[model samples]
Target: MRTEFDFAPLYRSSIGFDRVFNLLNNAQRLHAIDNWPPYDIVKTGEDDYRITMAVAGFAEGELDVTQERNVLVVKGGRADKQEGEYLHRGIGSQSFERRFELADHVKVETAKLANGLLSIALRREIPEAMKPRQIAISSGLSDQTAPLQIEAEKQVA
Candidate 1:
């Protein structure tokens, strides 16, 4: 059983949240129930993050990692190859793609594969102009007691 949410009301009242609403709508539409090759996300630091996925039977050449705009995509699979028949197969070796939504300014730093794990490192690099800074408030002419007066008596015809 599943339920769908209506975001029309929120769109009418909210501002500067179009992305959020779009993400919610996309999530509802995808509704993917696949959970193979389990992964974990962790906040390594204030501006750093990490994603680790367990891919027991995959190789470096069979995986791909890419980021476009605010989305991170990780795909794993290998080209079809004939091999000896196995008496009993236990490992999961199938094509899979995982997507991650990243906030603004968040970028992928590096990706590493070791033992049976794939680790992706991310960092938030906000631009200098976007980072918060102290503003200097100044007391302008408002503090002056006398108002300026124009002297035009000599030029009067």
Candidate 2:
């Protein structure tokens, strides 16, 4: 079965979400799906995530993890070997390309392979300026003067 995606409606909506519309319009990126070596994305902690991919026959040297422009790419390819006679060959060795979408500010922490599973951890740190802050209220009017209007001064400044 084949599936087609239409991004015309998204562009016509004009809901001020240009980022989403632009992403949808980029067909080259939209069609890139990782089907080889099934994987899972799990949220382990606050702002923490882990991506586990099943690479049964792939070795550490054959796999590579890299981040390019907010995209996590994992590629695996076995080294070429001379054809040898095998009476019973059950293990399958194939090359694959996997891509993952990462949000702004999200970065790859580390990657490790163990027990045929390749685990990649990611973390995002919220900027201090973007975090919420509590406002302090004055208990009473000061002896010199009451609360002065700072908006006018801010505007002039």
Candidate 3:
């Protein structure tokens, strides 16, 4: 049995949240995708993250990691020269593409492949203008000097 969600009602009720709805729809679509060459996502710091993928048998030249806007794409492929026939093909030897959704201001800092593992580091740097800041609040008009009355400044002429 398959279940599907109807977002029409939400679309009609909510305004200025198109991005949120789109993200939800994209997440639902990602659930049915293939999980090959297992990977892990870790939060290393408050705004730092790391993604590691088990990429055995894949050389550094055969893997490509790219960040486009708010999406991270990792692709792996082998030319398949057919070195030999495997009695039991346990390890994945097929091309794969993986995508990760990133929030605004998130960026890929570094990527390295070693010991059959591919690791990518990410950090989120919010702009100074976008970051929360303390605003000066006035308790009341008492905080400022009262305006000088025009009549008081003028003498009987």
Candidate 4:
């Protein structure tokens, strides 16, 4: 049994949080459950991250990694060309697609496949104008300053 949530009230009051609401809505609408090609996400540094997916039977050219805006997609599959019939098949290389949601300013650094594990590096590079900075305050002129007088010579008409 699945229950649908009403986010209209939340959207009416929130500001600048459309992404968060969309993520929540998408999570609720998942019809099929997929557990194949397991993956792990780890935080390596303060602004660095890594995603590792186990793709045992897939070759180097069978996988693809793409980043569109704030979404990271990884797909793996290959055509089957086996000669003999398999009695007991355990290693499955069926087509599988996985998606990951990334935060703003996060970008893909590198992707490498080694030992049946596909590792994707991600780094969050915030722009200089968006970073926080301290402002210096100084004391200068005041409103209580007196006016200056100018000396003038007497002239006959």
Model 1 bad stretches (over 4 Å): 138-147, 151-157
Q: What is the per-residue lDDT of model 2 for residues 50-107, given as tens digits with 9 covering 90 to 100?
A: 9999998788999999999878999999975758987987665678888777877899
Q: For residues 52-116, write the lDDT of model 3, one tens digit per residue.
A: 99999999899999999999999999987877987887878899999998999999999999999
lDDT, residue 52, model 2: 98
Stretches of model 2 off by over 4 angstroms after superposition: 1-16, 24-34, 82-90, 138-157
Off by over 4 Å in 4: 1-3, 140-157
Q: How many clashing residue pairs appear in each of the predictions shown?
A: 0, 0, 0, 0
Ranking by lDDT: 1, 4, 3, 2
Report the alpha-carbon TM-score of model 4 versus the true structure.
Answer: 0.84
TM-score of 3: 0.85
RMSD of 4: 4.9
Candidate 2 collision pairs: none
Can you write out model 1's per-residue Cα lDDT over 1-157, one digit (the tens) per residue?
A: 8889999999999999999999999889885578887999999999999999999879999999999999999999976665987898788888999999999999999999999999999999999999899998868865776878897769746
| Of candidates 4 and 1, the better by lDDT | 1
Task: Output candidate 3 Cα RMSD.
Answer: 3.2
Question: Against the hidden reference, what TM-scores do the models get?
Answer: 0.85, 0.70, 0.85, 0.84
Colliding pairs, model 3: none
Q: Which residues of candidate 3, in runs, are more than 4 Å off?
A: 141-144, 148-157
Top candidate, metric lDDT: 1
CA-lDDT, candidates in order: 0.93, 0.83, 0.91, 0.92
